[model samples]
Target chain A: MRTLNPLYPTCPIRNIINRMSDKWSLLILSTLNQNNIMRYKELNAAIPDISQKMLSSTLKRLEEDKLINRKMYAEIPPRVEYSLTKTGKEFMPAVDMMVNWALEHFEEIVS
Target chain B: MRTLNPLYPTCPIRNIINRMSDKWSLLILSTLNQNNIMRYKELNAAIPDISQKMLSSTLKRLEEDKLINRKMYAEIPPRVEYSLTKTGKEFMPAVDMMVNWALEHFEEIVS
Candidate 1:
């Protein structure tokens, strides 16, 4: 196995994991994974506990990271929607594995 | 898919991910995954950038989460070693998948 240097700023594993490891990113990603597409308000409503500020910033970060795309429509009030990018969609299998593991081990670890 | 509440303290996925999501824990876990068993100093040496205090605490947290085991020998100088617990070992396949994904997508995500 190749050596992993967690402190290396550009290390792929570090960079990827850092992005996913944040408190809200995975949840948001998984939320989009299930919903396919969501409006900003729908996402905020779905993740009830996240503040509007956090949700906005996390969405922006995901967009900047190329994990999710934000689309705006030219309409009366304007419609903005979020969905996982192809790369983001590709990443979900790993996240699914993690979610399954967490479900299986939740009691053992959290207790 | 089940709904995930990121803010829920007892939510299994959140709990497990939070534990693995820290700056050092996954790196330490992956290091141990590769090494099988290592002494405290060996771990410290392997990850050149981690501070002694942070290493000690992260190891403790992993142990507390039942991810790793600490063994001490009653010798003249005393010997201490660390290795993954059964649960920790079980969790690594998921980590491996994430690592593989990171390697494959590094350029696209990090650029």
Candidate 2:
């Protein structure tokens, strides 16, 4: 049996994987991967049917884990944008594998 | 961005993977993969420090997800043993990959 090393004080990779598998995070990261930065609302709108609350929470956790960067440009309307951190981009292959695996096998998994 | 298919109206593979990463499931399955079947307390004891409730809940979830089979032998002490289901075994390669990735990359991911 293998033991997990707790990351930082409280973070665990299991927790990280859970956050990565969050219904919104995969979409959000995949969306942001194309563009360096994306406005919060723009990303949300692009995700198609994600709840605002879910998007907010998922982004917050991803940022906390340093997987995504949340930058606020305090302009006229307080613009906030999200982009993948180096760590987040590194996991792109894994996440892409996950998505592709999902596409290929979810039907088989479901049936 | 890739879209996730909501599996079976509720059971998403994301959910399944989350459960698979349940801190106990991987160890539990890895333990059982060796012996094919084991009693609840025996598996718990083999896990070193797992709580009874946690083992129970994890096994219950695995059973509910059809990843495992629980056979209760109507003995004087009410013997019960757990074994992996067919679908569960198919996921062995993926789970092994996860464990290897965790063992190999978790340190890098942490620091």
Chain A (alone) TM-scores for all candidate structures: 0.89, 0.79
Model 1, span B2-97: residue lDDT tens: 234445866655667766766588889999999999999999988878899999999998998889999999997999999999989988888888
Q: Give me the runs in candidate 2 sitting further than 4 Å from their true place.
A: A1-27, A30-37, A47-51, A96-111, B1-27, B30-36, B46-51, B73-76, B96-111
| Worst-scoring 10-residue span by lDDT in model 2 chain B | B1-10
| Candidate 2 per-residue lDDT over residues B4-111, each given as its tens digit | 346334334344344455557766877787789899878978876677888889898777666789999989989998999886676666555544544454555445
- The ten-residue window of minimal lDDT in model 2 chain A covers A1-10
CAPRI accuracy category, model 1: acceptable
DockQ of each: 0.44, 0.17
Docking class of 2: incorrect
Q: Model 2 residue B83 lDDT?
A: 96
For all candidates, the clash counts are 0, 0
